[model samples]
Target chain A: MAGKQQQRLPREVRERQMIDAAVRVFSQVGYHTASVEEIAGAAGISKPMVYIYLGSKERLFTACIHREADRVVETVRAAVHPDEPPELGLWSGLRVFFRFVADNRDSWTVLYQHARTQGEPFAKEVRAARNRVIAEITAMVVAGTRMPGGERIVSERDAEILARIAIGAADSLSDWLLEHPDESPDSLVDRVTDLALVGVERYNTGDLPPS
Target chain B: MAGKQQQRLPREVRERQMIDAAVRVFSQVGYHTASVEEIAGAAGISKPMVYIYLGSKERLFTACIHREADRVVETVRAAVHPDEPPELGLWSGLRVFFRFVADNRDSWTVLYQHARTQGEPFAKEVRAARNRVIAEITAMVVAGTRMPGGERIVSERDAEILARIAIGAADSLSDWLLEHPDESPDSLVDRVTDLALVGVERYNTGDLPPS
Candidate 1:
């Protein structure tokens, strides 16, 4: 197995392998301590090959964030059917999100922990990735409430806040997923969806209960 | 001021000065790059004085987290009126939280960024502090809903989720505070409280309307 070099593999397959290995190492030891050499070694490729494929440790880290971020955003996009009830669609999207986090611990770690830990370039990459997901959520939120007979729950800006709230729930629940490894993603998804959607409805109805 | 050496100061005053300086240095550079010597220099004290006052770098970092966490918790505890309705209490708590973050950006940076970036001991310290706040929120949530005639919207476990949602909102809003430095904490507080409490109410009433 050692004699068959990973470099001999197709570029796409080889790059994926490097990213897979990179995520593991970065998550385990964290950003500052992880090295390109270690990532390449874990990928079973030469350091120069890693450099050629990914350029630098920084770029490799950014690529991992980009890939995982795309995976999460795309997962939600594919899961939500435009025609479904907004709550059901929201449930689906959130379930997809938790499942993605549950199944992809290494990926989640890269997107949340490592990416933001690095300075400006990488942190901005994470922010952009997150903003994309927030954008998707925001658009859905605007659609769900702005329709005829629908409750105008939140303002344009408030919709943006709800989008962040959803992201925050997903982010916090992702941590829960890590700790409660035996928990089902569907259950957690229901928990988060109920909390988030209910709040939006209350806000729309102006149900700010008096203390 | 130069004539009065920090070493000549009383223990209480000197310790506070050192922790204040540590927050600045740790926030400026990442934790791994921050040093006791640099912190001491920032504090206008000797290196040995820092060690004598705070024990070790690890202990010093832990102390910073502890101090900042105490400040936040105490701020909320002091600001909240025990007799106020649950929704109002939560609003007060969140408002104090955003105000704390805004006023003490350096301290917030230390708690949110630096402390977590360090390894297990430091991370555990941060976790404990956060858990304290979550515990406070959870207890309030349980009390608010468990009352007679109040909508028993959520289970004990669901109450736990509500606590986290509040935290998630505060966490994201803190980032927003960093970008929009001029924004008033009162306005942000109102925005967050409405979203959070309204959601809690909806949850209590089982207001899961058809999406």
Candidate 2:
């Protein structure tokens, strides 16, 4: 902005603003081109404060990755009930996943787009968050495959692959959602859940092709 | 090593070198930090030659995307026969997709990773590549769902969603393959096709859960 107007804000609030600005800049120009000065300017603070508050660019990016990943993991983790039907659990998890992406496009970009591709510092952090979510989904999937008396149909390994496919579908759909803003999470929840679970069930039953 | 060594090569050979250098640099440092000079240096040529041969970094990146995208599409398209059973077509296509990524890791990174994340100059090009392949797979999916007399079990739209799921699975698995280098493409082709096609079959054959 014009001449980096010094807004006298509390340290906590200022840090939030800096992080928010960094998300926008990093999402827009990506990690390499996004400068601390530009982020500070966008936050209406000085460059030194960005360094003081968030440390180096590497640290700033790491901060963004951690923050966004935590929010996504928290949002998704809080939504599903392990006790419910597994497909239902997947439906809830996917509903939250898409809702989270729709609401936080910048964070989505930061987490899914920019951060994953930024090499080691961001890669390790992003992968940890991803593996955690995938594991949770895998558990829900395993739960879902149980019959009325709790007889397991799909194997754990098969369930894990199905869970990853569902996650990948949601991830790709989330990217598609960015392009088509009006699409709602509820609409997608049914389509994706139906498409994925139907296939999983068929696989669990007699759907495997002649071997 | 000391000075810029001029490789007086043919236009075709020089362009190939430049694109190879680009794939390495862009994958290493990412699009924003990957400079034209760095690409030229990696190619063992000077800056102006890179410009003359590839036009601009933007064009060079576009070239890389097209080249890699073309290679992937050609490989997969050549592998799967449309007249074959749809699931088998999918199996063959995925086998080639994973094998291509395994053999050409840098090209895989450039096409799948860097090309997608870099904004609009590359977005349209990358999206075109993705949509083209998705469309091809969608057709194979539609073909796979045909009945004995050619009546279809899965509708066109349903097949498209399933195709996207399969593509998403392959994309995610390709990323997984990066971490597990020893894993064979054949092993994954079996698993992914089983998970995806079985679900589609159940969905088509009235395998819906009791309401």
**Model 1, span B1-211: residue lDDT tens:** 7546654667779899998998888878857788999999999999998988888888888888888888888998787776555556777887888888889886687667656554467767877887898888778767765647766756677778778777776777677776677787887766665655645554556653423
Q: What's the chain B TM-score of candidate 2?
A: 0.76
lDDT of 2 by residue, A1-211 (tens): 3334444446668888888888888888878788999999999999997898888998988888888888888898898887766655666777898899888887677656766554567777877888888888888878766788877767786677777777777777777667767667776566666555544544466653523
- CAPRI-style grade of the A/B interface in model 1: acceptable
Distance (Å) between predicted and true CA of B4, model 1?
Answer: 24
Weakest ten-residue segment in model 2 chain B by summed lDDT: B1-10
Quote model 1's TM-score.
0.75
lDDT per residue for candidate 1 within A1-211, as digits (tens), equals 7546654668889899999999889888877799999999999999999999999998988888888888888999999987654445666787888888888876677557656554567778878988898788777867765657776665666667777777876777677677787778987766766755654554556653532
lDDT of 2: 0.76
Top TM-score model: 1
Please give the range of 10 consecutive residues that has the lowest summed lDDT in model 1 chain B: B202-211
Between which residue pairs do clashes occur in model 1?
A: A153-A204, A199-B199, B153-B204
